[model samples]
Target chain A: MATPVYSGAARTPQRGRPRDASRDDALRQAALEVMAEVGYRALTMDAVAARARAGKATIYRRWESKLDLVIDTCTQLAQQNLTEPDTGSLAGDLREFLSAFAAFLSGPIGKAAQALVGELPHEPELASAFRETFLTAQRGVLRRILERAEERGELRQDAPRGMAVEIAGAALIYRLMLTGDPLDLPFVDRVVDQVLVPLVAKGQ
Target chain B: MATPVYSGAARTPQRGRPRDASRDDALRQAALEVMAEVGYRALTMDAVAARARAGKATIYRRWESKLDLVIDTCTQLAQQNLTEPDTGSLAGDLREFLSAFAAFLSGPIGKAAQALVGELPHEPELASAFRETFLTAQRGVLRRILERAEERGELRQDAPRGMAVEIAGAALIYRLMLTGDPLDLPFVDRVVDQVLVPLVAKGQ
Candidate 1:
């Protein structure tokens, strides 16, 4: 079993009180706009504060650093936009998951992720938390969906092969991060049918 | 078909005589050392020149910017390390290719790539050339190997599915770039046997 390395060192908590919902919304929207405009390297907390019309102290109370702010903005976006659909079968469950996944990748959070990715290697805390806070949350959704389909006997006994489970997600990430390609509905369908469906479906 | 978009904008060739082989080797090696030491963002052309004991002109004459130099060093490393294996079976060929791929990812060039990936989206010219110069070259090798497998009846005629052709490479990349997981031979073997072999083998 590949032990999940959920390192806690990365998620350095904010020093002040928890963020209010509307304030949080304004700050994150500002973060995304700044990220898209300036790219990650040039993106600064001051600029985000300026853009959002929030005081610098308000931004700091929520996030410790620019890296934290960006990561939080993305995390908030994921929680807001992400949902798992139960379509009664493994294929449909996955199609629903991927459709939502593709849309997420095309939206604001996805753009933030792309911009922030280059900094991941240099920032250990950000990298670890990103996997746990963001990527793991998404994977957990997929895992539950797969488990349900298996219970219904719609999938192979050895379905959701450990690392192979990542093929769809990994391929999608590869297209976005490395290859600089677009992710769309048709691309999602092909991965599900050609790769995931063929590999995991029962009595194929 | 995805048209090959090879814009000449990124690779602004130097207006100079051909670089000497030994000097080029020293500069590239120095680039790797500086990258490993300071990472991509901090790496500078002046630093590379100082480290390699070469003039700043020598470095600039060869590369337009630090991004160009880094990409070129990675490209050269890929050409040097990349090789095709006639392993006679799709499984064997994939195994051989992945082993080499794993080894490369664990090496100096791999380290450089890890360091540079975060900057891809911000650097359009570098991103485009990276797809063309580094990634496309590797994929071509895999494609030829797969085509041979299909010809020998070892694979389904449409064996290497369109997007799924990326599963192996993408999985490996996702592990490295996103998840911060190690890409070892055993990891490589599981993806081949479980995900890839099952997905494409004839009579599955």
Candidate 2:
């Protein structure tokens, strides 16, 4: 039930001592490592500071609380991993973007993220950051692919857009988190071909 | 990553006394309550025993570890809630089953379960129990409905059986855990109607 402090917006930059980008990067990486090791509930600002080799006051100056630090760090990490891959076709574009996403989830940030994702509902700010910085970004990539497909006459005008955006990612996550299934290239291909292509692609 | 100790097996009954059914029930309920309060990684046997008003030794004698106790408690709770409802059509059967599941997730056991689900990958035994006791059981119900539909010629013979079974639940979980979206009756209806019905229903 802890209120999560989000990283973006509403912060007037302090006048004295401009922020150090490298030190901030170090702290974000440290926060991820600490969260991966200890999980969300046990994560403390002191632990992140110690891990990052920065003074506690330094961390506090940037982030109002531990949740803020975590949200900021994770948001940065997700943004860093996400790139919209355009392959000219919706199927190819989806596979590229989602495959990139699946790879990220299999990496350090994603591993750390799993520990915190379960707790998103308790903290409104955290959930918002997760959606805005991560989930929405991923969905936005999918949405763009669909729109382009429509322009090229590759997608039907009435393909259930909401359901189209959701099913592939939903099924992939279920396989990853719930079933512990292998998320390889071939698996991604199947999701696109079988589920996604069937759902939306024109003249398939 | 700690290997989770599962509850159903590998317990050699301690020589002194057979476990009383009522005492066992009390312990499981107490374990659930404690987990609902503290979450999975922080849950301890001492807390469960204290909550149950039983000696720590009694709990230890039966279950090997806290993970074992939690798995047992959650599995029992899931089983208690899982009853195959036959509503003649796949859509009705899915709606009824998933609705019941959504209700359980909104309750005490489900609330506590959200905290533990994230840790499943770290613990092999815990993941197995989850897949076996809860997830597989739920899937099994869906499979039966699908099979029955096929038998009645209500389903296409070439419908991707695996994807058909997976999409609805996956979308629901995506909404519940990832999107933090409301899993209300209407949302469930869309998942069933928009996604699921299109996936398998004949003549779509």
Candidate 3:
């Protein structure tokens, strides 16, 4: 399995000029488009470069292999615009977090994610990248929300906090990958009001 | 793209003698082993037949194609030994249902199911089979549990019944596929006591 190198996290000394953010975004977007069209199996550097209107050498310069490129794209997809919201109340915080999550599930990132699910078991590097980036970030968001609720004295002290993250992550991902249901606000509200509220709220 | 042929559900008239139950089980088990070893993309009927110590002709007499065989294997894996339990109380029912589900996730079927997750997006017929067979059956089990709770007056009438099932299914599958955590009785108890119990209890 290949070790994925995030742009800034590489141990090697930084080269001359810093990589362009816009160029990286365009490359990742191109990779996502090609992945959504042909899936992870058929994706290639040439195809991604052609789609991005860049030379193939440009892709190799950043990512060591196709696996490296896909992992980076997945990491970017999960981390882009992901920030913990400070919505005062537990319900408010949950609503903000889940709404953003639902948006991710309803867009191109979600489609690309669907194609990656089957590959996880076969690809150790990809699986670890997913856990380190997407899964960890998701848990971190929910954990902060619960922490704020705890500080506000709005959550039960004995609440199973880890399970709370598991439920939220599972419900959304399951719907996206397995059920093929619409990941809309109504569904997000169902997760928030129906489950998260009852499970975490200090008093019912 | 081939439609899966479940026994006794085939549109074509009964052909000759009824298929042997033991024979079918062997083939499905063989398919699962090969899938777990090589994944869905590389799985072939020849490998399955060779593993089962059966001729290719015997395999074809049942499944029309490789997709057909894999789908049937998935359906069988999910449906095997799955039955609704009447544990009477809501929490008891949930514990039993989740324990059985946890058991499935901890076994060989779980490994095979993991590989199938990625293929679902690319294969329409397989996706529908999953929804109709596995997903529907999962919902049906939870629905019956909730209905029984309603009869016993243990559940809130306005409770979000569907989200309960989604949470149960999602949490377990997410843990198995993404987190690579242990799906034990302790985990099952956490789901029951923490989320499902609070989410569904009438007066919680």
Candidate 4:
């Protein structure tokens, strides 16, 4: 399994002429587009290279394989403008978080993710990369939000943060993948109001 | 896409000596074994026929395609014996349910399910069959249990039964598929006590 190189931990910044930032952006975008169009199974390094108009060596220079590239692309795509919404209460934060999450899942990333889950078992390296790059990062965001709620006495201390996040996130994915249901705003609100808030809310 | 054949909802039971029940059982078992050895993607009608020591036509006679065979096999295998544990409370029923669910997800069914999820997006027929056979049936069991709890004045009137079931089931699957974590008894208990019970329990 290819371990994630870009942990949030401080790394000594590479001391050299910076690689072409625009080229990197282009390659990542190309990768996401290909993944969205054809699933992870059919996505190939050569196609990404062709789409990005870059040499295979250029992609290989950064990522070890297609899995690595796909993982990195998904991570980049996922990190677009995550703002923690504060509605002055846990209910407010949950609503915003769930709503944003539903939007993303309905968008390109979600489609790609639904495609990736099945492939994970067969491709351990890709699975590890996905866990490290996307799952861990997303969990971190949810954890921070939950921590804020906890500090405000909105969430019960006894509630398990990890389990809560999994339930909230997985509910959305299950609906999308199994039921072919749209994760609309009303659905998100209902999930937050009726499911998550009550489970984690501090007082009875 | 193979359309499910239903000879009307009220088809009279065929009045004949029950056709080779043991043969049907053997074929289903054979399908599961092949799925475990090779994944769902690699599993084929020819392979299943060879493994079961039956002709391809014989297997196809019962099931229209690999999807039908596999879906039927999964449905048979996932026949969970969920006896409602009456520890005199909702928490007890939830705990028992979670424990049993976690055990199944950790077993062969979990591996098959992971493979199925991967296949679901690309194969619409298989996805639809999976929903009707396994996912829907499982949800029904959980729903009935929750409804029983609600009737006993143990649950909120507007508690999201479907959402709660999805979350509970997905938490187990997410851990197994993404994290490679063991779904031990304590984990099940935590999910029940912390997530499920609270979400459904009566009163704020």
Candidate 5:
């Protein structure tokens, strides 16, 4: 059997004074930095420890393995600007979501997210953690936004909000991953105006 | 420098007893099979040669490196279906394109494609070749279909065909790569009928 390369539950929780929470933040940030700089394949626990100015024990105290640390860092990075906007209109809310989502993709988190996706098939646990922590959270935000829109009678009666969320977010990610293009304001504008607004508009 | 793994350019141009092209085909198929079984990181050229019952010289003669062989094989596997229907309308054409595209993603190429994307960052040359061969070809297909739609007055005159194509294909790829979903027919139908067609239709 292929050995388990990573697992979140493998870490033994510390019983003493809670370790420096600040160090946790620094380590997570360091993980993202190293991943972006060297790619996921080259990232190592030692590198993350050195970059964060923390001992290897500190990292191990929190994450069971490098994959665990990477997943946590990705989760934290994705959550940085995940607040949902309530502009009272589906267009406004979706525009904000897409804009923030685009910024995240083009920002540090984007690099980490791409690296994580690249690592998924090789590391099944990392893949599962990524879905639960990052993708599922982001999808939740989009679902809530769409649910509000649907309640307001903004979407077609037969429209699937979950699929809508998938389409919107997937469109942006596809560009980032496959095209290797910068996510610009104009592209965001086009996605919102052309795709989101019309799909959610009451009448066809 | 890393030792080259493939041998596509080394063979002499001989007329008598042309090298068995069938052996080359067998090796490529075997490579993909091993990749699906053990993944890209653990795959070996010797294993491929053994699987094909061909000498290592035969394998190296056709590909200069493992990356080269893998990329060529992926291109061959991916090139199976590129047909786009006229259908007399943009929606119909897009629906057809997406359906066929989904089929490829769920088929043999899908697993190899995922493996390749996972391996790209570790191998930039392979990534570049993948983009040039597979991604560029697929994008061209979508572009041609969209361009024809615009010419037929089905798409908005001001609509960005490039962005539209990106969104359509990206949405599908994103779900496949991140969500691990099946990219089912109903999802494709909803995206085509709800998200794509209305977005590209003329007039707000």
Candidate 6:
């Protein structure tokens, strides 16, 4: 399993009583649910507080703005959901990782992630935070998987390792964000066997 | 050149003084420019009219709402930009097609497309129009390219042809939306040689 790398390292110093971990998690989860349902434009701190059964002041105390809360929520979600699979072969590892990824995209965080992509070009701060935390962590999972395959000599030395990682999960994302297609296991397997396997695994 | 497939076939019947072709084109171009600058959420019919130097009534006479206007704008953009390349080989076809595609994504319509992606899930009308018009037309171009390769005996009989089209342009979309990276020829070439070639071209 991939370890959670984000530890709130960039968070501003808290001024009040120490933050409650459980409450923070609940608020973040609620924020994601709201975002998944209504999208970022309609999301507000009041809605998040209402969904979390917490006070608006409580949310303000922890995060400066709704965008901050969302960034924190997505970062936490990435840390929790990302896992490294050692399935011994490149194809096996890709299958495992992509299946898990497909399932993640089918959930609330996945929908919320789509909600964020449209705004990234406009919101530089959120864009940087997303790339730095969630995207970096997700890429690291695939990078390690590819590196292990290279070590086993199951991949060509000149294999497009970086591009493979980028392309691997892209089908599911393209489906989710663009086509609005359901992400299924069969589709995941096809991408693994037909796309990732051919592109990265040694000796086509 | 890929023929302009969309000819406003889906546009609602206009019920005013005969619409001006040059004026409508100006309105759509203005809509794209405003969207690229302010994003979908901030776009307004009045703003589009102002940018196009047309009256608000002129804008509404052509389209029912701002969303309707955007949908029309994107459809026109797709028709104007998509070109089918005949380079006698899949690699050459993809290279030409992708370079044109990369250039398209670097412009105003490209920015508007990203702005719309965030709202696709929330707006079923826009989603269906996007899928039916812009997305379908794009897939058709790639599908033709792959089918040509198959006919020439360059691709395996069962070479994941549909998946090839899906995966081929995914890296560019991934970078433009997720990573906030610059899309350049070198990156485009890397995707072609490193990923697309190995995935689709027979015998690696």
DockQ of each: 0.61, 0.53, 0.70, 0.56, 0.45, 0.70
lDDT of 2 at A173: 79
Clashing pairs in 5: B5-B65, B6-B63, B6-B64, B6-B65, B7-B60, B7-B61, B7-B63, B7-B64, B8-B62
lDDT of 1 by residue, B1-204 (tens): 122222222464756587587888799899998987676768999999999998999888888788788877877676666567787888888888887778888776666777777667667877877787777777777777778888898777766555546887898888878887778888888888888888878887
Chain B of candidate 1 vs. true chain B, TM? 0.86
- Where does the lowest 10-residue lDDT sum fall in candidate 6 chain A? A4-13
Ranking by TM-score: 6, 3, 1, 2, 4, 5
In candidate 2, which residue pairs clash? Answer: none
The alpha-carbon lDDT assigned to residue A38 of candidate 2 equals 78
Poorest stretch of ten by lDDT in candidate 4 chain B? B2-11
Off by over 4 Å in 1: A1-19, A37-43, A64-68, B1-19, B36-43, B64-68
The superposed Cα distance between candidate 4 and the true structure at residue B37, in angstroms, equals: 4.7
TM-scores, one per candidate: 0.88, 0.86, 0.89, 0.85, 0.82, 0.91
Classify candidate 6 by CAPRI docking class: medium
In angstroms, how far off is A12's CA in candidate 3? 9.9
Give me candidate 3's TM-score against the actual structure. 0.89
Candidate 6 local lDDT, A123-145, one digit each (tens): 78878877887778778878988
**Per-residue lDDT of candidate 2, residues B1-204 (tens digit):** 111222233322455676687888898899888877777767889999889888999899878788678767776666667567777888887888778777777666666776667666555777886787667766777887789888878887678778777876787777777887777788778778877777788887
**Per-model lDDT:** 0.75, 0.75, 0.78, 0.71, 0.72, 0.79
Predicted candidate 3 versus true structure: per-residue lDDT over A8-60, tens digit per residue: 22212244768887998899999999988887878899999999999998888
Residues B48-158, model 5: lDDT tens digits: 888888788777776767877787777665554546567777778778778878887878767766776666655667667767777776777778777788788778767
Residue pairs clashing, model 3: A118-B118
Residue pairs in candidate 6 whose N, alpha carbon or C atoms collide under 3 angstroms: A2-A84, B2-B84
Tens-place lDDT digits, model 1, residues A1-204: 122222222444645566487987898899898887766668888899999998998888777887777777777676666666777877887887787778878776666777676667766876876777778776787787778877898777777555546786797888778886678888888888888877777887
Tell me the lDDT of model 4 at B166: 75
Instruction: Give model 4's docking category.
Output: medium
Pairwise lDDT winner, candidates 2 and 6: 6
Q: After aligning candidate 4 to the native by TM-score, how far in Å is the CA of A180 from where it should be?
A: 2.2
